[model samples]
Target: MYMRNRTLLPATPERNFQMTAKERREEIWRLIRSGLGSQDDQARATGFTVSRVCDYRRLWKFILREHPAIADGVTCEEALSLAKEQGVKTKR
Candidate 1:
């Protein structure tokens, strides 16, 4: 014969999720487009660390080099999509 279990645990509330790298990049781009120049402003707007914002800047430069059209009023989402389509890997 098997013994029955009796203990039950209470459910915990879920915490808010953090932004992913792609989302952070997109947010940073938006801030830049909206004229937020400083890294501090980007960090505040995107909730990313200063180093991560700097990383995004580096990635943006690389992306711009590979795709000049991205600098010509292309949306951040479109640029990211094009980068993926071209198999350009973002730094992890």
Candidate 2:
């Protein structure tokens, strides 16, 4: 099969695959809060699909807006627990 030259395609932003789960999550949150890109762009930068990016952004916004005290300190598990207790709507 004839393959096109890979170099001709636009380069993707470098993504850090070595980060721990927490570190990666924090980075995604930072990217979302930084307002440096659109949802799709942020997703691409973080190596996440757009839906996951949107989900994280929504969860972060909810935590900040509704539970400011715990927003910065809460872990993903804790956030999910809080969301469950508060009946926060989620797609999954």
Candidate 3:
């Protein structure tokens, strides 16, 4: 039926042109979270280039920096082990 949350990804050039980089990033995140299609398809459907869409995950790098606090007595090894135990699959 082609029905999805229309507001998730902006299709109009006018609206997309008005989006800030942060807004664009959020839209891409929403699109990926919905898992409607491959990144290329999602990008094309959302009026974005495949290259730009493929690089969108760079916007989420901040989460990696949120490693558990060492001052709180959590070592890097301990944090990594905990992350693995929690099923947090990091790609690097």
Candidate 4:
């Protein structure tokens, strides 16, 4: 595939989704709070599907907006960097 094929083509590498449920949630939260991309983008980064992103989109937005500081100390840049570092994949 070429870069023009997909704009949000992960821009990074691909990582494994070998995390526990708790870890997955945390990553999802991190991605959400990161504000790097939309829920679908985050889901793809965290090794999840767009459907999963849709499922938690509302709640995730609530937490990110209403709660704040939910991602612990992980900043948006940090979270995005971590995703890139982990080589997260987009199943497109």
Candidate 5:
């Protein structure tokens, strides 16, 4: 007699539509900090492409100007949450 298990691994949810560009940029910075090094090193460790790393850095600079608290070691999720709490909207 053969028995089949009904349990199956759940599929990963799609990430494309969930995070906005700002959120994505913040996430990249978080990855960089989590690695504790330069963009090149962070990219290597996080598996992000060099071009993506550059974009993240540029976006991070812009975000930092708008939100100084981000530089104070706030997590990307926290930053996004704070922005939401403040009713900030992303530019289209």
Candidate 6:
């Protein structure tokens, strides 16, 4: 006789729409802080291309270096906005 195990894995809900820039950046930051430093790993986790992950990583690195307060949440949305206001070139 053969028996099937009756365990089910939890599933995440599907997203039909793309994440906003803010949401994407936040997710990338979360994944980075989770300690998966490899761009490939981040891309797989975020369902983004490796190059896209690299772009977000570069943005975060720039923010951390040039504007730690923004990176650390002086305000939500300040990172990109402030960077633009400062005339820093950043790819969204």
Best by lDDT: 2
User: What's the true lDDT of residue 43 in model 3?
Assistant: 72
Ranking by TM-score: 2, 6, 1, 4, 3, 5
Q: Residue 89, candidate 4: how far off, in angstroms? A: 28
**lDDT, candidate 2, 1-92, per-residue tens:** 11133212211444446666676666667666555566766665566688988887788788889999877777766776788799996444
* RMSD, every candidate, angstroms: 15.6, 7.9, 10.0, 10.6, 12.3, 8.2
**How do the predictions measure up, each by TM-score?**
0.51, 0.60, 0.44, 0.46, 0.43, 0.60
For model 1, what is the C-alpha lDDT against the true structure? 0.58
The C-alpha stretches of model 2 lying farther than 4 A from their native spots are: 1-14, 69-78, 89-91
- Candidate 4 lDDT (Cα, whole model)? 0.51
Off by over 4 Å in 1: 1-27, 33-35
Q: In order, what lDDT does every prediction score?
A: 0.58, 0.66, 0.52, 0.51, 0.53, 0.58
Candidate 6 lDDT over 1-92, as tens digits, reads 11123322111224313666566566766765444446765665456678777766666677788877556663325665766798876665
In angstroms, what RMSD does candidate 6 have relative to the true structure?
A: 8.2
- Cα TM-score of candidate 5: 0.43
Question: In candidate 6, which residue ranges exceed 4 Å CA deviation?
Answer: 1-22, 74-76
lDDT (C-alpha) at residue 26 in model 5? 61
| Tens-digit lDDT track of model 5 for 32-91 | 544345665544433456777765555455457777865667765665565567665432
Q: What lDDT score goes with residue 47 in model 5?
A: 49
Question: Considering lDDT, where higher is better, how would the candidates rank from best to worst?
Answer: 2, 1, 6, 5, 3, 4
Superposition error at 75 for model 4 (Å): 14
lDDT of 2: 0.66
Question: For residues 53-89, could you state the per-residue lDDT of candidate 4 as single tens digits?
Answer: 6545544443445446654565434444444565543
